[model samples]
Target chain A: TQLLEQSPQFLSIQEGENLTVYCNSSSVFSSLQWYRQEPGEGPVLLVTVVTGGEVKKLKRLTFQFGDARKDSSLHITAAQPGDTGLYLCGGGGSNYKLTFGKGTLLTVNP
Target chain B: EPEVTQTPSHQVTQMGQEVILRCVPISNHLYFYWYRQILGQKVEFLVSFYNNEISEKSEIFDDQFSVERPDGSNFTLKIRSTKLEDSAMYFCASSPIPGYTFGSGTRLTVV
Candidate 1:
């Protein structure tokens, strides 16, 4: 089974602070996606990294895929209270299934 | 932006009863998926549907679970004889390829 392991299951930070969450797996994936979910809501896609060592940034958020496609990272710069939510990483393999990580609960206090 | 729509945001049903969750994927998307997340647990993939048939399913998707794209836009997931353990937030997703767009989800509470 391909499993994605996320680090720092829980995080608490003040507004304007910076934080980074990591996702790692022993198996390689064709693509990796990051999602942010609020309470009582489904996950919303943030970004998808398809190529190895690729980095994509969206405003204050930055996502990076490992050179081997076995790991990924999400970095938030100048975090805000609105950014507080559950961050998830999903790995898409050769098949149609997507294996999701346990997720990191982020709390950005204003 | 197009979105995947799921019906019945919340459902409470007795154990051993049958329940069907519905979804309307994006008009142009070809792939559909079902996933569930128990409280405080990770999101788990249940099944994937493509071309009016199931392409992949996880171990958690057993005989009790079935999926159908009966019409042009509607996708449904039927859970026959639901157990208390089946209670969770079920999310429906659609994608053109690997990247998915998920619905708001239906919170299924099997009592």
Candidate 2:
């Protein structure tokens, strides 16, 4: 089975600080997506990257897909209290199933 | 934006009792999935349904667990007999192909 390994299981930073979360895998995927989940809520899609070496931005957040389609990253700039949540990275493989990572719990204190 | 909806935000059931979780996926999406997350853990895939039939299921989805798309809009998951270990947040999701939209989830507590 393919597994997406996420690093920095937990992160805590003050407002305006920048942080980056990473997800790596050995198997290639057709698409990679980033999601943010708040307490008592489901994951909300942030961005979807299909092509290799692609970058997509949403406001102060940036998402990048690796050149091999086996990894992805999420970078947050000027983080705010609202940015505190669990960040998950999932990739759709050949079977079209999204294998989600363990997630990075980020806390941006004000 | 359109989103998936689930019923019973939270439920408490006795162990060995039957439980059913319901969901209404996005109107236009064709693929549906069920996922579970234990407290302080990552989400785990339970089952995927397409065309009113199951396409894939995880080992965690054992004989006691079943999925059904009784109507065009509603997808359901049933556990024949609940267990203490079954307590978790159950999420339902739908996607046309690539992007999946998940529901707020139902918190099941089996005691």
Candidate 3:
């Protein structure tokens, strides 16, 4: 079984602060995705990084896939209250299933 | 933007009763999946379906759990017998490629 471990399970910062969350795994992945979930709602896809060393930016959120495809990172620039939520990183391997990380709970206080 | 939809936003069932959770995936998507998240816990995969069959399933998806694409659009997850540990938020998701769209989810409570 492959496991994806995320660092700093919980984070709290001021509205204008920046933060980064990391997801790491020993097994290589075919693709990786980032999602943000709010209270009482399902996860919303934020971005998908398919290729090794690929980077995608969505407004203030930046996502990066590791060169080995075994890890990923999500960086939020000047986060806002709206960005507060649980951030999850999922990895897809040879199988059609997605292995999800424990997730990082972020709270952006205004 | 199309999204996945799940029915019975919340369900309360007896410990030994059966429960069926329904979902309508994004119209054009072909793959479907079920995941569960216990309160304050990580989301864990249950099963994945494609071409009317299960492509993959986790250990957590034991003998009591089953999935079916019965028709053209709806996907369902059936639990033959509920247990106290079954209380969690069940999410239905679909993906045509690697990016998935998940439904609002159904909170299942085994009383």
Best by lDDT: 1
| Higher-scoring candidate on TM-score, 1 or 2 | 1
lDDT of 3 by residue, A1-110 (tens): 88999988999999999899999999999999899999889999999898999999999989999999999999999999999899999999654588999899999999
Tens-digit lDDT track for model 1 on A9-92?
Answer: 999999999999999999999999999999999999999999999999999999999999999999999999999999999999
Q: After the best TM-score superposition of candidate 2, give how far the Cα of residue B38 lies from its true spot, in angstroms.
A: 0.5
lDDT string, candidate 2, A44-83, tens digits: 9888999999999999999999999999999999999999
Error of 3 at A10 (Å): 0.9
Instruction: Give the alpha carbon lDDT tens digit for every residue of B27-85 in model 3.
Output: 88989999999999988999999888998898999999999988889999999999999
lDDT (Cα, tens digit) per residue for candidate 2, span B1-111: 898999989999999999999999999998999999999888988888888888888899999999998878899999999999999999999999887899999999999
- All candidates: interface RMSD: 0.9, 1.1, 0.9
Q: Scoring each candidate complex against the real one, what DockQ results?
A: 0.83, 0.78, 0.85
Ordered from best to worst lDDT, the candidate numbers read 1, 3, 2
List runs of model 3 lying over 4 Å from the truth. none
Q: What is the interface RMSD of candidate 3, in Å?
A: 0.9
Q: What TM-score does candidate 2 get on C-alpha atoms?
A: 0.97
Model 1: per-residue Cα lDDT over B2-74, one tens digit each: 9999999999999999999999999999899999999989999999988888999989999999999887889
